[model samples]
Target: MPRSIATLLFLSVLAGATPVLAQPGGTPMQLPRTISVPGSGSVTGTPDKAQVRLTVQKTNPSMEKARAEAVVVVQRFLALTKKLGIPEAKVRTTSAMVNPEYRWDQPTSRQVLVGYSVQREFEVEVNDLDKLGALVEGAVDAGVNHVAPPVLDSTKRRELNRQALAAAARDAEANARAIADTLGVKLGSLRELTAGGAEPPRPPMPMAMMKATMAEAADAGGAATYTPGSLTFDATVNASFDIVSP
Candidate 1:
C-alpha cells in the first residue's frame, strides 16, 4: 500500500545571468543572451477513484498447510469482492509471500523451525465511494488481517496536469516580463522551455488518523466510516527567452 509520490519537484531556473569565462584558447567566450525564470502552479480537487488494499496472512506447523490455509482466505476475499459487485478487472493480487517461522531454543542455545507463514495482498479499485466503508468491513470479515488506509485518485489526471502546466508557463512569462521591465529592456520571444512531473506527492498516514479509524472499526464491526478527501496537484516550468531591443 505504499504510494510513490513525487515531492513537488519544481524546475530549477537560472535567476539572472552569469558571464562566460575564458574559452579553451584563452579567448573571451560569448554567453547566450537569454532570460530564465522558475515558476509553479497548483490545483485542488476531489479524486474520482478509491484504492483499497488488504492482506491475508496464515501460519501453520507445515509450509503446505500454511499455503493451503492462505489460499482459502484469499479465495474467500476474492469471492466477497464478486459478491459486492466489484468488477473482476478492478481486483488483483498485488503480492504473495512465504516465511519460515523460528523459535529460540534456550536449552540448545539455537534457533529452531516452528512453523511457516503465508501472506497475500490484494488491490481493489472501488469506483463507488458510498460502498467504501462497507467494502472494508466485508473484506476484513472474510479473513483479511491487514487493511491499508484507502487511497483516492482522479481519472482526469492528465487534464488537471495540463492545466497546472499552462498556469506555470504563464507564471514564468509574467516573471520574465517583470525582470525585463525593471532592466529597461523590451520583452522578447521564448527561445526554449523545459519542465515535467506535475503531480504533488502526499505525506504518509498520520498516527492520530490511524488510531481514530481503528477505533471506529472496532466499534462498528470492523467497518470504519471513511471520507474521501481532495488531492492537490502542482506543476512547474523553466523558460528562457531571447533578449530583444525595443
Candidate 2:
C-alpha cells in the first residue's frame, strides 16, 4: 500500500478510539444533600381502672383436705369482692392447680409423698381508685396469701393515643423547620411521613409494705386511703420534607 494511504488508515483508527475513551466514568453520581430527623411526644392522663392478681394457696396432710380448703378460701375471696360492690363480670378466676408435695429421703435415696397443695388465682378489676386498697385488704382477710400489685390503665386508650400522635406530628414539623433554618435552607412541604405505634401504659410499682398496712387498716374496719397515679402515652414520628435553597 502507498504511504499516504497507510497514514490515512491509521488516522481513521485513532479517531474512532478517541470517542470510546471519552465515555462516562463508571462511578455513581452525586446526590443532593438531605437530612433525617426524629421527634417524640407524650401525653398524660389519669387511669380509669385497675386490675390485680390474687391467689389462694393451701396445703394439708391429705390432698382432699387441701382441695377443700382452697375452694373455701376462693369462695370467701369472691364473696368479699362482691360485698365491696365489684361487679361479677369484673372478677374472674384465672388459674387453678393441684400439685403433690415431695419429700426427699437422703438415707433411702427415695422420694416420699407428703401431701398436696392447691392454689387458685383470681383476676379483679376495680373501677374506683379509692376502693383499691380496701379491695386488696378485704381479699387478704378472706385468705388470699399471694397478691400481685394492681396494674392501672385508662379505658379510653384509643383516644389518648390519637392525641399523642397529633402532638408527635406537630413536634416533627417543628424539628424539620429548625433543621432547615440551621442549614440556611427554606422548609418545603412534607414529602414523606411515618409514625410509630403508641406504647402501652406502664403501671406504678406496688409497695408491698404499703399494701400490708392497707390490709391491716381494712381488717380493723378503718377506711383505707389510696391515690391513683397518672400514666403517660408516648409516640414517635419520622418525617421527610423537600429542601429548598434560599
Candidate 3:
C-alpha cells in the first residue's frame, strides 16, 4: 500500500476511539451521578360506611329440620335489616353449612352420627354510620346471637388515594433535594420516576366483646354515642435525579 493510504486508515481508527474518552466535563452528557431512594407518605381519613358479620346456628334431630330453622333465622335477619333501611344489595349471605354432630364411641372405636347442626353467616354493609348501634341491637333482638362488631370505612377512598400519591411525590422530591444538598451538588433534570402500587385498605382492630357489653349497658341509661375512628392511607415513590457539580 502507498504511505498516504496507510496514514489515512490510521487517522480514521483514532477518530473512532476518541468518543470512548469523551466525558461529562466537556458538555452535559448522560452520566450516572445520582442515587435513587424510596420515600413513603401517608394520610388519614374519616370512615363513612360500616360492615357487619352475623351468624345463625341451629340444631335438630334431622338435617332437614336444622337447615329449615337456619333458613328462617336468616330470612328474619334480612327482614330486620330491610326495616332498618339497609338496602338488600348491601346485605348478602356469605356462608351456609349443614353437618352431622358426631359422638366418639371409645369401646367400639367408631364415630356415631348424632343430630345435625346448620349454620348461616351473612355480611352486611351499612352506609349510615349513625344507625350502627341500632342495627346491632336489632340483629340481637331477631335471634342473631353471633354478630360481629361493625367495621367503619370511607366510601370516597379514590380521592384519598389521589391525595396520598401527590403527597408522596412531594416527599420524594424533598428527599432528593436533601440528598443533593448533602453531597454538595445541584439536582438537575429528573432521570427516572416510578410509583408504588396502591395497597388495599387495612381493616381496623375489632372492638373487644367487653367494650361492646359496656356500651350496651351505657345505652340503657340514655342515648349512646359512638366515636368513629379515622383511617390511614399510605403511598411510596422511587425517584432518580441528575446530579450537577457546582
Report the Cα RMSD per candidate: 8.9, 12.2, 9.6
Model 1 worst lDDT window (10 residues): 4-13
Better of 1 and 2 by TM-score: 2
Residues 61-139, candidate 2: write the lDDT tens digits.
7999999999888888888887889999999888989999999999999999999989888898989877887787777
CA lDDT scores, all candidates in order: 0.76, 0.77, 0.74
TM-score of candidate 3 relative to the true fold: 0.79
Best by lDDT: 2
User: How many collisions between residues are there in candidate 2?
Assistant: 0
Q: What is residue 190's positional error in candidate 1, in angstroms?
A: 0.8
Superposed model 2: Cα runs more than 4 Å off: 1-34, 212-221
Task: Please give me the total number of clashing residue pairs in predicted model 1.
Answer: 0
lDDT of 1: 0.76
lDDT of each residue in 29-132, candidate 1, tens digit only: 64556778987877876776788888899999999999998888888888888887889999988998999999999999999999999999899998887677
Ranking by TM-score: 2, 3, 1
**Once superposed on the true structure, which residue ranges of model 3 sit more than 4 Å away at CA?**
1-30, 197-201, 209-225
TM-scores for all candidates: the values are 0.77, 0.82, 0.79
